[model samples]
Target: MTPTPHDLPADLDVFLAAAGWAGATVEPLQGDASFRRYFRVRKPGDKTAMLMDAPPPNEDPGPFLRAARWLDANGMRAPHILADDAARGLVLLEDFGTARMRDYLDQWPDDETAIYTAAVDALVRLHDLPPGPFLNYSMSEYQREARLFTDWYCTARDLYVDAGGFSAAWEAVLGDLLPRQRPGVTVLRDYHAENIMLLGALEKQGLLDFQDALVGHPAYDMVSLLQDARRDVPPELEARMIDHYVRAAGVDKDTFLADYARLGAQRNAKIVGIFVRLWRRDGKPRYLELIPRVWALLERDLAHPALAPVAAWFDANVPTALRESLGGRFEA
Candidate 1:
């Protein structure tokens, strides 16, 4: 199926018309496996607007909308929803330009500390969102997502771990995790270097990919930051950030460590699966290149007693040949 503009579902035009975001060149922005298409619409004498076209009946923008609102109210900066048509599954948002946080990190590596600290502060605000009927980021969801490593990544690469091996490891790790998730906190489920913006003190300080936000482990976002699949933050830098986040969040030392270990494992599991899915389903091989850094980070984090079971499992059963292949790809 060669996808084209006409294939952009019919409601997009109607949404552009209703929102007065016309005559702008709508070019697709790269995104994950969602019907979401971001168009950099540049019109004559008009402030740039990012037309978020997530076609309806397949995908819903409700969570994205609600999360954006929540972030805005909580003193974090996600793009303001300029216009919304839930039925049409389209949203027009204030464009913050293309300066993503990753771009800044690449350009000015020395500015990492300040940029990351600022992002973490904003994250603190986001996580401070008061409890509500918003769905819980329960262990079950994490387990389900964690399984993606095998189902997608391993499977896509013709790699496999026996059921006994997989189950034995996951069960032990999860048992440890159950106790650690005691004082739950909101999780941005997918907060990473890429999801953030580099526009410091500008209009949109951060761009939110908060559609997957959930109430879960507090350490989740921290894990996302340190164990980023796309880029490897040095271990020393990661430790500093860990301390910064824990202190800023006002959590106890032991409590933060336990949860951090658990969340780190959870984050690694999710990314392993996601990378595989991106490759197999979306044909995105770029993620494969990052696999080694991710695995190395996971290996380092899993050195904690909390993740010993999982660490050993990968050590024993996930296969050296497979690890060598994935690890080498990531290193390159």
Candidate 2:
């Protein structure tokens, strides 16, 4: 069942009272693509905090709490957890204010390069840290994610694709990369513009929506940032940021660039399927609008020689007409 604000726990007030905000004004905020919902808690004296209601059976606050603590402890800017009730699935977190990187960029387009530079710096800092306590982003995981394109996307488009070939192609492409991911850095799977909050300075990028963090290749998060699904990051800027990260992290340029394209293709494919599922199954058609942009990014990723096998699979299955026609066909 999809939870609404009215479906909030009965003891929510009691939980707030226990947390020393007995009568705070709780204003519901817009939700993301999950069962979890957030509320802005404001009290007398202009005090503020964010409340996350991740109800049980469908959602869990454990991973979010664990990741939050780990990021905060490691000198990162994840929101501070003020209070939590794991059994009830409620948490009080520090409010990082209203300056989201996505919105900020929209207002100040001239600051794009500088802001992206800081974001790249943040990734370098994070990759420098030892691996966090998280599940490994193994080859099986990559395969499972990539298969979503065939499973949901092809099915939704009423196109009969070779699902087995899709799997084999991804396996061939990602096989060599998996060996490099041993004891990998923490990959905040959804590390993109909207999830990054700008706290005072561009360098102070506060992280969010990171419950699904995994130990994976350093290039995954970089791809997420540069090849953003929700926004149009200029190709020139993306190239510059890749150069910046390669220099800052002291990694082999050729290997990292290949891995970046590989991971970008994998992630973009997964997102295309997820958006379709969100619309067809979850009744959220707005996500369908993002498919065209994602397809463009995915095509760019497929241009790399590292993704030749997967590229062949796409060429043989998902034709150019269907790719370009998504916007007209899937309108909400």
Candidate 3:
């Protein structure tokens, strides 16, 4: 299902020609589990640009294009949209280069703290930005995303859906919990290691795959960064990072911890299901390898006792084999 560079539309030739360019070469860029495809472009005497080959009909570049403009105006760095055909679903972008935070972590282990700290700070700034129409991610939206866990993790895997109570309980919890969150700023839904690029000592951060941003809790992005499933951000370091945010935000510890735990648990549950869907639907089983770490994070945040019922439900009904496969017992 992955499309190659050769699959690009003939419009590419016209666009390149219109720009008065010569001797352009295209190289397939890194991919993610989405309808979009990217390629790096090489043009003489200029900085690099990216070619977006979004699949027709199924995916639209409207959201991304609008978001890019919104972010650019708001002191954020989203790729500028150069050209586009709404019907064809293609657009050119400012290339953010090929350095992923995951790869960056692979190269420099010692700089983990600094890099993650920078990302956290970036997240805080995004969250604190003035509100806009595009920023809205209301309760209905939260319910929809949270439902992914039940759909994929519970139903697709057929592992456990305890007592018919899980659904109602989760819904009830959201009904009560969601109102507590203060929302307004933009949330780059996937702010983890993969979407961010460490561009040369993090001076100019490279942001990609940010079309799904929503207006949600400020703590939500922080939870995504500190409790990333893809990479190992040490527990001690994560704690310190949270503390740093607390100091920066100038909020009370108890209030911040409660929101952090609630949203962290919420995000991780969604990710557990997301990885399941990635494996089952997208044929990307490698993501399944991180399920355990995400589950471990889920358990840690669930220990707050607010999630006691949800924790107990998982304990009684979820299969031991699945627990093992995902990454051992919660107690472990």
Best by TM-score: 2
lDDT of 1 by residue, 1-103 (tens): 3347785657566677777865555667777656687776667776688877777776889888998887777676788888998777778887877788888
Q: Once model 3 is optimally superposed onto the true structure by TM-score, how far is the C-alpha of residue 136 displaced, in angstroms?
A: 3.1
Give a tens-digit lDDT track for model 2, residues 1-332: 33455766668889999999997888788999998889888999989999998989889999999999999999999999999999888999999999999999999999999999999899999999999999999888999999888888888878899999999999999998998888799999999999999999988999999999999999999999999999999999999999999999999999999999999999999999999999988999998888889988888889999999999998899877886664236655
Steric clash pairs (candidate 1): 137-215, 148-273, 149-273, 292-330
How many collisions between residues are there in candidate 2? 0
Best by lDDT: 2
**Model 3 stretches with alpha carbons more than 4 Å out:** 1-6, 19-22, 160-164, 201-203, 324-332
lDDT of 2: 0.91
TM-score of every candidate: 0.87, 0.96, 0.88
| Least accurate 10 contiguous residues by lDDT in model 3 | 323-332
lDDT of 3 by residue, 213-322 (tens): 77766778888788988887898998899898888777777777877777787788888888878878888887777888998888788778666666676677677677
Q: Determine the C-alpha RMSD for candidate 3 after optimal superposition of all C-alphas.
A: 3.6
TM-score of 2: 0.96
Q: Judged by lDDT against the true structure, how good is candidate 1?
A: 0.72
